[model samples]
Target: MRAVIGIGNPGRNYIGTRHNVGFYILDSFAHKNKLDFLPTKSDFWKAESVIDTFRFLLIKPTTYVNNSGLVINELIDNFNLTMNDLLVIYDDVNLDIGNIRIRKNGSDGGHNGIKSIIYHLQSDSFPRIRVGVGKQKDDESLANYVLSKFNKDEINLIDQKIPLLEQLMIEFIANGYEKMLDYFSKESNTNSSNLS
Candidate 1:
């Protein structure tokens, strides 16, 4: 069993913020694949899909971003899955816009949602895809920055990268983490800026 969780705040107010990029990416990916998400009993919206024999769950937490662990842990327990069975995707302000990084495991790097997941799982061994939301300007506070929406130019940049990102999400589901390291590394980061 496999699961992908996209962390973001739930509500119409947060719909277009940079912090919701995870949800944006996952929603678009699911849509492109013709999958529909069904709201579950818990604080999650879920859809199931398959690529060949690989069965995977696509989930977006309906909980606020900081409390995301509750949704993750619930799905983990209900599915009887290990950390290796999960892949998390979220926004990262540390990298430039449209950049993405994939890693097998690491510390949360000060992201509250990641920190909450680490706390609930008591481990940091899960795979993750970090989508860059770009660094905040010096004048903006971190909270204000993340909760802010992308500007028109930034959204256009991300729009250009969507197909590649959707492909990456599909590849992650089909290949797991190891098979595509080079495909998503910094060298490929440059390619994300261009559409094929």
Candidate 2:
């Protein structure tokens, strides 16, 4: 089974924060697909369903962002899932808003949650979708900036992008990273026009 893990801090206080974009995307995907996420004994909100030929488990790790790997590794072991069968979704500040970057394997690039995942899994061979949260101004504290909710304009952009990201995710699961990259890269280029 393929595992799609969305990383974010778990709490009502974190809802709508930039850092919770991962959870938002996954939730949107589940909603669009008519999948219900139920609380699991493993300390995660999970939804299991098959799309096309892919059998998938959608997971929102409840261990919070910093300790996300604990839940992810447990699920991986329990399900006997290979590294390649895993896909992590999380927010990245390095890219512009509404942009997504998919990488087959790489370092966390300063994302604490991803760092923890790599540390616990002892491998970086998994695929990942990095949703852009946009960079903050130089004077802003990183933590505060990430935890802050998006402004109205940003929210409008994100609202438009989430469904497109979901569609790209479906293609990623159905095809692979190369096809997804080709698709999203072109999509990003047309984002402005599409949003208009």
Candidate 3:
């Protein structure tokens, strides 16, 4: 079993903020696969779907971003899953907009959600997919910047990128991380030539 946990604040107020891109990506994946993420008794919006032999649990925590670990830790313990079986997808302000980085393990790098997960899991060995939200100008407050919605131009780019992310998730589950990385790393060139 594998778990794909997308971290973000839960509420209508946070609907389209950069911080909620993780939820958007996961929602896209679930929608593409015909999976419904109805709320469960565990206080998470979750859905079960299988890609080949891998059974995946797609989770969006209702505990909000800062307290995300509460639900994640519960899922980990209840499922008896190891760190390797988990893949987190979240926004990263440090990365350039529209870029993504996949890592097997790493520190939270100042993400409150990731920090909470690390605190609860007591380890930093889980795999993660970091989606770039871009850094704010020096004059902008980090909180305000992250909570802001994307501009029309940025939305157009994100519209294209989301499907690619959905494909990557499918490939990551069906094949493995390396193959998914290879495909996504060269996505621009492939897309230019009309190849998926």
| Best prediction by TM-score | 1
Model 3 C-alpha lDDT per residue in residues 132-154, reported as the tens digit of each score: 88899999999998899888887
Tens-digit per-residue lDDT, 133-159, candidate 2: 899999999999899998889878787
TM per prediction: 0.91, 0.90, 0.90
TM-score of 3: 0.90
Q: lDDT (CA) for every model shown? A: 0.83, 0.84, 0.83
lDDT of 3 at 105: 77
- RMSD to truth, every model: 2.5, 2.5, 2.8
Return the clash pairs for model 1, or none.
none
Give the better candidate number (1 or 3) by TM-score: 1
Where does candidate 1 have its weakest 10-residue lDDT segment? 187-196
Please estimate how well model 1 matches the true structure, expressed as its whole-model Cα lDDT.
Answer: 0.83
Per-residue lDDT over 13-105 for candidate 1, one digit per residue giving the tens place of the 0 to 100 score: 998898898899888888888999999899899999888888889999987889889887789889887787788989889978877778888
The TM-score obtained by model 1 is 0.91
Q: List the residue pairs that clash in candidate 2.
A: none
